[model samples]
Target: MFFHFILIFLLISNSIQNIFKYNLFHHSHPSEPKKPSNPIVIIPGDAGSRLRANLTGKPSTVHIFCDKTTKDYFDLWLNLELFSPLIIDCWADNMRLEFNVTTGMAQELEVVLPPSRLRTMQRSFTSSALLFPSPKLWGPNETFVITPRKNYSLSNIEDFFTDIEFPQGLEQWKSESPSLIIDPPGVKVYCIYGSEVKTPEQYIWYHNWLFPDYQPYLR
Candidate 1:
């Protein structure tokens, strides 16, 4: 509950700061209401905060080759090169948070502790990894329900429609999708999505070098 309030405060304060900056630089209307001079905290966005991981020690891992410990904190989340082919799993494993029934909290397998529990701030960190902000942390809200889904999933319905054009139809379809059903809207939906970006809809083939068309169905 407290965390949610802090986040809401940050967003509102940052928005006010932007308005003040605009008023400070541009001409204000004669009848315009006075802007508040209150201070503001800058809103942080994706990849804004740096992340580092240090391997304390772990009992064992499924993959014997996976690093069990690191001498110092190393870059964890920010590297795209790690996501190539067979290497992606290792990168993800490093960031995976396991729920602990004993502690009633998630931990990084007691292996990589940075993302799970951030301590000191670092400027030298390579990639800025996201600390999982569990919805439970922000408490409940009546306005909306946010369901966390897999980072990349074969959930795009249009992706399935595109597969009919290819040699393999539904045979190649892969799914870890939450659902395929779409209910008719009962309330206003203010969709905010990227239009120019060509998102992957069909999975013909993928290579690290060649990026594919990215688009979402415009309703």
Candidate 2:
């Protein structure tokens, strides 16, 4: 019995010493295990991580109480309170995904608007364009390139809608697009349209003249 106890004690002592040595080697001269190199993501220097709200005025909202955008920049992702159900509804309404084919980025919320709603939106765009004239630094002669629509212009209600019967007595379609009639002085209008996509009103076709900067790289 005494001999058996001694053998058991030796085995236990050896096992404990081996464990200690193993731990000591790793802890003392720790080697950083090989890992795949992480690729550095370089974005534009002007681009920032701040979450800002710039209202891209929608013709209408999903929720009447939901706001389109906020006035100030706020930190998101880290804000735990925003996930709450009470605050989530409002946040969700404002959170929209707009996909831009050109930039390959999610950008705009494409919502179809009847002529009635588009009328108000169209005016805002033309008026805003008038308020802020294009920069003169680009020189007196600024080239305007507009791709002509394959279908009839928005003014042609009967033809523009194709086989669909023109909705009559609902106000003239020309009124919805004042810019089409009264072209901005010194600005030649280029009418670009996709043969595939159909638009109800002229607002979208022109990309809201308010965004004049977008004219260059339209594709």
Candidate 3:
């Protein structure tokens, strides 16, 4: 009877030891940490990011005709009055006429209003009309106009074309360990362009100039 009791006690001790050993091994050798998903950050192409005139307190200045003299012109072009596909076609025809005349101007005055600038202005009008399709969609009261910043400096917008900087905070985020990557990658950036727009090449050129360290995918 004494021998049987001793044997039973030994069996129970060995089972408990085995269970503890298994748990300790698992605790010490956990599964590999999961790789984090990279985050995405989209930076829009020309006139895509909302811009406001610091001087005028107006938003979406990209829609505004920069050199229009009369409110009527602003109403028709900037406010997008009587905006339709047919109207856009007529406007584009008029712009082509204007481009021809402007390109013939003497070199001194051409410096002030370059042919390139005129073409961009023409494209902005037609692109907006096509993208929005309806005046109500591009209306002044729309949240798309109101939700973005009201204090973007005109000079800043101009400067962005030449020297835009990546946010410094994002640089730090990119340095984190691979496992900690979350839903969004540490730094996600997209440069969006329209098929009709010719500015993508210029944008890619400047983007590369600004961020030579990183190679961005341009699609």
Candidate 4:
């Protein structure tokens, strides 16, 4: 279909821009924590995005999401990798964390800090996220298929997994199995997979597709 052709074209066109690089910084945490708390913004550079995408083999975006017991806010401008790679700097009261995307198909989720705020863990399963070049190119690929690496229930996959909606000319495709990884030292990443490739619009969809680990903020 026209959609699939667009997806392939975009994939081939990913090289249109040169890879970007960025640096990370650290801020001091408050001695005491409070109710409202402070804002936290974590930005990964373009180099980070490519490292993550290569490591996970899925399209990736970078952003910061914050929440309190009563309210939540998403600073779309804080979503750095989607636009460009820049050092996203912010402060917080009690919470401390950093994020990154690594390279290699075998994930290096290293967390050496035992009880400190820094720690890392790993899980094995099959998952996939699709990528489209642009809206003008959205379409379906006839070669798409799902492969299993371990025993599990295919029926349990989220409805979005079965949903593929690209534009007329571009289609999306991916080989499923654990292609996405979030290897922050102390923080756990909430992975959000969407039904199609599109620009970041609704804040809720952003949370759904990107911040799966922060369930408390949603409730």
Best by TM-score: 1
- In the range 43-118, model 2's lDDT, one tens digit per residue, is 6322222333455565666655556665764543323344433345555555557677899998744435435444
| RMSD in Å for all candidates | 23.3, 22.4, 30.0, 24.9
Candidate 2, after superposition: displacement of residue 32 in Å?
A: 29
Native-referenced Cα lDDT, model 1: 0.45
Q: Across residues 98-186, which tens digit of lDDT does each residue of candidate 4 receive?
A: 34455434443343434322111111111112331122233223112222221112232322233322221121223422333334558
Task: Give me the runs in candidate 3 sitting further than 4 Å from their true place.
Answer: 1-69, 72-93, 98-163, 168-219
Which residue pairs does candidate 3 place in steric collision?
38-184, 38-185, 39-184, 39-185, 41-188
Off by over 4 Å in 1: 1-49, 108-219
Per-residue lDDT tens digits of candidate 1, residues 1-219? Answer: 999768756765666666667667886779989888879777654321255667777666545556788889787544544433334556667666889899999865443343313322321222221111223222323211111221222233334335323323222222211233356679888988987997432233233222122222222
For lDDT, the strongest prediction is 1
Error of 2 at 150 (Å): 46
Would you list the clashing residue pairs of candidate 1?
198-213, 198-214, 198-215, 199-214, 199-215
Give the alpha carbon lDDT tens digit for every residue of 74-160 in model 3: 222322322332334433432232224657853311223334434444334423323221222233232221112221122233223
Q: Which ten residues in a row have the lowest lDDT in candidate 3?
A: 143-152
Tell me the whole-model lDDT of each prediction, alpha carbons only. 0.45, 0.44, 0.35, 0.30
**TM per candidate:** 0.29, 0.21, 0.16, 0.16
For candidate 3, give the lDDT: 0.35
